[model samples]
Target: MKINSMYPPGASGGIRAYASATVDGCLGIRGIKVVEGGRDGLFV
Candidate 1:
């Protein structure tokens, strides 16, 4: 299964919470990867 989670580059807690949830459902998985992307707009 492939899971793609997208967040607003700097949405602090969003990424953290998503990661925790993914790990919680892992059952003897061979491998997993967490990829993050930056937002496509101004930082301000």
Candidate 2:
């Protein structure tokens, strides 16, 4: 499944919300976990 949003990363807008939703969906799949870090592709 493909998901797209208009919110920016960690910006508390649609993008961030979409990311969180995607994470939840990914987790729903057995043995699948979407591990994401950093901020907007930059290392933390």
Candidate 3:
């Protein structure tokens, strides 16, 4: 997975940012929520 675009949220609270993403370079996702927490660190 790769982040195609990322920008900080206009408001603060649970979500930290909004983003678009791709899997193996294909445009397969959009409006994905990015948040903190998880053993690995970040949860998409």
List the pairs of residues colliding in candidate 2.
Answer: 7-15
Candidates ranked by TM-score, best first?
Answer: 3, 1, 2
Q: Best candidate per lDDT, number?
A: 3
**lDDT of each structure?**
0.36, 0.34, 0.80
lDDT: the better of candidates 2 and 3: 3
Ranking by lDDT: 3, 1, 2
Candidate 2: worst 10 consecutive residues by lDDT?
A: 12-21
Tell me which residue pairs clash in candidate 1.
Answer: none
TM-score, one value per model: 0.22, 0.18, 0.58
After TM-score superposition, the amount by which residue 19's alpha carbon in candidate 3 deviates from its true location, in angstroms, is 1.3
Model 3: pairs clashing at backbone N, Cα or C within 3 Å: none
Output the lDDT of residue 18, model 2: 28
Question: What value of lDDT does candidate 2 attain over all alpha carbons?
Answer: 0.34
